[model samples]
Every structure is written in C-alpha cells, then in structure tokens.
Target: MKTFARLVDDSANFSSDITYKKGGSILSMIETVLGKSVFQSALQSYIRTYQFSNADHEMLFEKFTEAAAGTVKDWCERPMNVTRFLDPWFLQQASALKK
Candidate 1:
C-alpha cells in the first residue's frame, strides 16, 4: 500500500503502488487452506451476492465458510481467532503467510 509521490507529503502528483499488494498471496492462502474449486465458487458467489450491495468482512467470511463445505469442511468448521487470522496479512504493509 505504498504511495508513489515526490519528496513532499502533500504532493499533488501522488499515486498508489499496487505492485507490492498482497491480494495474490491472500487468495493463494485461501485456496490452499480451502480448495481451488471452493475458493473460486465462493468468490463468484460473493461477487454475485454483493454486486449491488455493500459487504463487510464478516459477510465475506460467512460466504467463504458456507461455500467451503465438504471441500475443507474440517478447516472451515474449526474455530480460530478472527482478529489473529486477518490482522497479519491485512494490517502489515508487506506480509504473506506460507501456511
């Protein structure tokens, strides 16, 4: 989420750098923990469900958990600390979990 700008903090020509984004790693983790098919379907459903509506993180998680049924049932059903689960990848500027 680094910004592309000159020395000045208030530079008008500022821009964002998406090169170092973590969306790919996040997707890979979700796919690996769940399954490619489930992940894809979940994402598709999420898109369709929220096409014209605003969605929160909880809604996305619920969709994924629902869609992950039978594919990664155990993992999806197991309880985990949501904050700990999401904070690393989302809060950190440059971080990606291998597991």
Candidate 2:
C-alpha cells in the first residue's frame, strides 16, 4: 500500500508552514490529538479491509469509512442533528472539504 510518511520537526518549521496548505490543514487536527492511537487504527483497518477491492481514491475512502464505522463507529459520525462535527452539513460543505 502507498503511504504518505512526510514528517516535519522544529528546525523545518518554515518549510512546514509553506507546505502545510498542500495537506489541507490536517496537520493541526492530527497534532491536536497526537497520542490518540485508537483513532490511528483506522489506517490498519483501511489497509486490511479495502486494500484489494477498491482501487480508486473515492471508493477507497468509502470503504475505509465503512470499516471505521464497524471498528470505531463512534468517531465516524459527524454532527448532523447531534453535536458531532462542530458545524452543520451546509457549513461543513462550505468549509474546506478536502480533509
């Protein structure tokens, strides 16, 4: 499976700053909850569940979400009527959707 292992340290902060926009602000979300290993398990779950079936990115994500919903169902839900995503569906659509 392909892996995006790019990492940055303090000394490379300048480069990180310049390059971060390319990664869609995910660095902040990930770094905020850095030690949450249970959430990280989604990677292994994705690799196991959809590695062979879905070859495209969209299909891959759909399969990954399905797997995560099975394994970590609670994290997969976004606030619709519930207080999940901080924003509603329209706002979520307006906000950066790449992540």
Candidate 3:
C-alpha cells in the first residue's frame, strides 16, 4: 500500500481508489482522532490562513496542534506532538492500520 502522500512518477496511473477512497478514509480517521469540533476548527483555520495559496502538511498540522493544545495529552493519554504523531501516517503506508 502506498502512503496518502506518496510521490507520483510520470508513468503513474493515479487510480481513483487511491485518490478518493483511501484519501477519504484517512481524512475520516484524522477527524475521528481530533474530534469533529477540533478538526473542523483547524480545517477552517487552515483554509482561511492559506486560501488561494500553497500550504503543506506541516502547516496544517501546526494548526491542529495549536487547536489541540492542552487537550491533546488528555485525548492521547500522553504528551505528544501532533505533527510527530501524524507524520508516520502521512509519510509511510500501512502504518495507520497497525494502530
């Protein structure tokens, strides 16, 4: 399985199953982890902060971490950096399934 952010080569087919299905599943999982309210708020902030501009995963994760400050440890039951917690999910394939 490829990661959600896998690099595409010139010969890549770009299947819809990967683009839509897996993408949707990953997004749903992220929302579930953050809770709907925090997820939505961070999403809105990300959009507003980067509308009509380019933004990367780190930027989005920063907003999530900011929104989740203080409460993240409670939710995760340990102190963790949001970006660190999510990096493996975006950087490697099949890792999310293990959790």
TM per candidate: 0.57, 0.32, 0.70
Question: What is candidate 1's local distance difference test score?
Answer: 0.66
Q: Give a tens-digit lDDT track for model 2, residues 1-99.
A: 899978755663546644546444543443233224533554566577677774544443343344344334334354111123322322342344545
Candidate 3 residue-wise lDDT, 11-45, digit = tens: 45656456567667767877887789988998999
The residue-by-residue lDDT of candidate 1 on 61-85, one tens digit each, is: 7777778655464435664333345
Question: Against the unseen true structure, what C-alpha lDDT does each candidate score?
Answer: 0.66, 0.42, 0.76
Return the TM-score for candidate 1, rounded to 2 decimals. Answer: 0.57
Model 3, residue 69: distance off in Å is 0.7
Q: How accurate is candidate 3 locally (lDDT)?
A: 0.76
Indicate the residue-level lDDT of 80 in model 2: 19
**TM-score of model 2 (CA atoms):** 0.32
- In the predicted model 3, the residue pairs found to clash are none
- Mark the 10 consecutive residues where model 3 has the least summed lDDT: 10-19
Clash totals, every prediction: 0, 1, 0
| Best-matching candidate per TM-score | 3
